[model samples]
Target chain A: MATYLLLSTLTDEGRKTLKARPERLQEVNKEIEAMGGRVVSQYAVLGLYDFVNVVEAPSNEVIARISVELGSRGTVQITTLPAMSVETFVNAIKGGR
Target chain B: MGFYVVLTKLNSDGVRAIHANPDLVSAVAADIQAMDGKVLEQWAVLGKYDFCALVEAPNDAAIHRMAVEQESRGRARFTVLPAMDMALYVRLMGQSTETTGPHPWQIRWPVQIARRALRNYWIDQHVRAACQPLTVLGRENLDGLARPAIFIANHSSHLDSLVLHSVLPAAHRRFLTFGSAADRFYIKGRKGMTKQGWWNSLAMATFPIRRGAGRATLAHAEWLIDKRWNVAIFPEGTRSTTGKMSTFKAGVAILALAKGVPVVPVFLEGLREIRPKGTRDVAPGPVTALIGAPIRFAPATSVSDATYAMYQAMEALRLRLRAQRRPDGPEEAT
Candidate 1:
């Protein structure tokens, strides 16, 4: 199984209005963990948005489900991007496309 | 300053999640520090997220900005929380501090002497008035209780102590003093009845009990009792705002057993609904007091054993009082 990084942004609703609810964040974390995805790290920021959470899952599909779960809360918009290790990056660059 | 932690993970592709990007995390941390927030610690974790960063800011807003900056970087998410000092929290919630506010009895006092005179007069009058209405169930039990005793009671409202004070004979009242917290009552900048309560208590020979001072405060209480002043302790340590009795602390039991004083149990009812906790307003209501037969302390008992026994006896008395008040239904009793 391959590990995938899950990056998410709190929507405007989440950042400005729903940020006060610590229970919501707890619930989100619990849900992700129950689904076999690991929350490797999490941060609550204040610049452009409210929070940022880092997650690790087995596949892109798991990341997609995490994103949908966040979106369904209607508190924040989420965007997920797949990441690669330095070794994979080196190999891909060496393969010439 | 505010503290924060960031958790994130790396994806299958070379691109990192918003929470996991090293550059973004560093920039966000720098931004927070530049804005007067202090970054305490940042580390990578294996479980929930890729990394966790702890930062401290001047205010909540600054921390919020830091969280936002990290999010826009598209790496990870975060949760921020405010931390409280345990000592401060315990002190604020302890029984001694609970009574430092303006009580229903304080409105009549112009100064310390006036407060004492008024309290004496009111207790006498109220005790006389309550004699016919208030049922005396355990007086036979208290008869001949000559030794210095620790009077333990279920606190409901401001009137619990007042009513107890009224019922005790003038001699017992003279030797007896109730515990009140210094921080709440004697603090330098307090206003209104709280300050007045402190002064009135001092004038009435009520000594200050520092909350959460632990064994030291307990030692002071022992000294006062050993000096033969009957000390009335609210073992629940604070009044119950919900009208239901809270769990009693072991300090009362410890003091009682240590001093070899009889633990006199008193149950007060209908006081919470009358004045409620943390308020000065009094709503007219009939209040009742049931003084349990005093339990004697044996010399063989250790402080720990005595503390447990005290709690058991108190809990039994509380249950008895609850049963009396709600003889027919469980719903009426707390």
Candidate 2:
């Protein structure tokens, strides 16, 4: 599985849903797992985005689906990015494969 | 000089600080200029990214320093992107010291060929020395191999492919193609593969392919095979997180069937413990490659059956190796 970084912000409707049903976060996690992507970690950050999610998925297509499925609920707008590992980065610059 | 862009976002305190000091934006621009790059444009946007700044720097390093220094202050976080002129980019990619391109017919200088030869020789020697206790169990079995073929092996550690490439016979090793993830390895192109550019590309013999379906990479592999080059693939798709094998994907089977080539089953052991998935540490250990005989299916054989047979061969090899392994061998080097 490849690692992905998801920067997400809750929309007005999503913020309301999350405010009312805090338990729904776990349900979303389950849904993400069901869609073949696992949330490695999540954080509420102070920045342009409200939430930061580290996810692992079988393929790029699978992760894109997870992002769309989660965003379609209108609770949160998710932005998924394929995260490059330190090893790959170093390898790219190191000139040795 | 290089063009750069930064997408910046301010925190609540940053917003409050900005209100307190309306000159904060100008201060940011000055900071960018101080870093040897001039801010060309600035915009406040309403979205995930708050502010977008365009700058032209003397070099990429200047931009990197600017971004790092800005983030270190904790007022804002920036996503940095470097932009290059299309003409300059094409010139840089095309203007090799010795000419080379996607096609091999391109002429290269003798110095370029010599440099690559030297690099390959060094790599061969380096791997041989680095893997001191490496035992390739099936060398004799692979000695008789004469034609181009595909080698399917387990993926656990990052070192698997390197070690495999290092241990292969010269004929098999020469011009061998590895199916690397296109997204990771081909991020930008030749430079994306490695900083050394053309040299690294030739040394690694990496052919970038898409992750899921075999459409893009499969065709690349087939092309390489047609040119009398062998290809290596990890049919388990991704590396085994737990070091246990996963179901073989049909991509390998399809490639073998389409090319009408034999599929060689290779089993790697001990490398995972040395350097497993999701890790950067490299522990020294004895790694072994148990090579099995090639599995060739008849023309009428189904892809699924061929895949299953390949999987079964690898499984049986693992079992046999386990049965023969000693309980107390060379302990894993810490």
Q: Summarize candidate 1's per-residue lDDT along B28-135 as a digit string, tens digits.
A: 556767877766655443344454445655557776777777556554556555433222323333323234432323222354356466664645564454333555
Question: Per-residue CA lDDT of candidate 1, range A4-68, in tens?
Answer: 43445556676544434434565677888887788765555444334455577887787788778
In the range B1-334, model 2's lDDT, one tens digit per residue, is 5566566778887776766655676688888888777886655544566665557675567778888998888888887766543322323333332322222321234533653576546455545544657888777767778668898888887677887787677778765667765544444433533443344345566665566645654886787778777888888876775556767878889889988989888888887887776577877777788888888889888999999999999998888778778987644221
Question: What is the Å distance of residue B102 in model 1 from its true position?
Answer: 19
For every candidate structure, what is the RMSD over all alpha carbons to the true structure, in angstroms?
Answer: 16.5, 21.3
Model 1: residue B100 alpha-carbon error in angstroms: 12
User: In terms of TM-score, which candidate is strongest?
Assistant: 2
Over 4 Å off, model 2: A1-97, B1-122, B125-130, B189-200, B329-334
